[model samples]
Target: MSALDTDRYHIFGVCTPKDYCLFVDYVIDEIKNHESSLLQRIQETPDPALRVWRESTALQGTDIFEIECVKDRETAQEAVEFWRAYFHSLGETIIEAGHLCDRLD
Candidate 1:
């Protein structure tokens, strides 16, 4: 597949359930307020760019959230920056963020 077809861009990390709930709530608010273009796109599209799940571990389960899109680099960058800023505004430190091309074929 062409580089343009790659679903490489993603913002992913693990966080506590409390922080995860807070983050999800913030995104839901943005969607309701129509305040974010990236989020609106995800909401409107048949295929979403955001995904969240929980994984059980030896310790307490961790909430993992990933925002990704199979679109152009610029659009992906915008989504990444939007989440980065949002997390920063909430004083939430991202454990990892960036294009995750290497994680796939």
Candidate 2:
């Protein structure tokens, strides 16, 4: 595995209406396909400040899908805020949001 790969998980629980699945998936696909993705941003960050929350980032599950990323705790929090702002700016009402690091149970 590469130096950036890790078993650590940064999981964010995001909620929206069930009807928003298409919209959510669309945005995720756009990110995955484009340069503005979280992974891209982390890769582009200069060293001394460089960080990674996941080897891959995707919005998974149904309307209540959890975004599961990777790496450290601090980076996980940062990732949550990054996505939270991104979705909010797109006019999505984040009626519910939460985040957790690794597995506790």
Candidate 3:
């Protein structure tokens, strides 16, 4: 099981390896063009209960992401929606979305 299974965080996002390189390149370019806007958004929120994370799996060429809110499910859902909108605004395609829950182990 992953650490997410043991943590108090709820995670969700989309993934795709089909256009991984293009996606990554676009992300880098977008960051360069919109770093200020991105930073401003985070600063504006500044929610102590919220955490955002990203991971790139080389073997799978998959980029997995999650918005972890150290709060209730409602808060988590809100955070996920916020990110979903942000990514969509950037023209990123979300192939899937879900949450990470504690394992039964």
The C-alpha TM-scores of every prediction are: 0.38, 0.41, 0.39
Candidate ordering by lDDT (highest first) = 2, 1, 3
**Each model's lDDT:** 0.39, 0.40, 0.37
lDDT for model 1 comes to 0.39
- How well is each residue in 4-100 modelled by candidate 3, as lDDT tens digits? 4434433433344644321111111123334344334333433432222132322221233334434444555566667667777788764332332
Model 3 quality (TM-score):
0.39
Q: Give the least accurate 10-residue stretch of model 2, judged by summed lDDT.
A: 21-30
Candidate 2, 37-85: lDDT as tens digits: 4334334434321222222224333323446654665666676666656
TM-score ranking of the models: 2, 3, 1
Residue-wise C-alpha lDDT for candidate 1, range 1-105, written one tens digit per residue: 864465444444335655443232222111222333433332333422233322221112234345544345565556666776787788875434223232221
Q: Whole-model lDDT for model 2 versus the true structure?
A: 0.40
Residue 29 accuracy (lDDT) in model 2: 26
Positional deviation of residue 62's Cα in model 1 after best superposition, in angstroms: 4.9
Q: Which stretches of candidate 1 lie over 4 Å from their true place?
A: 1-13, 17-62, 68-70, 96-105
Residue runs of model 3 more than 4 Å from their true location after superposition: 1-7, 20-62, 96-105
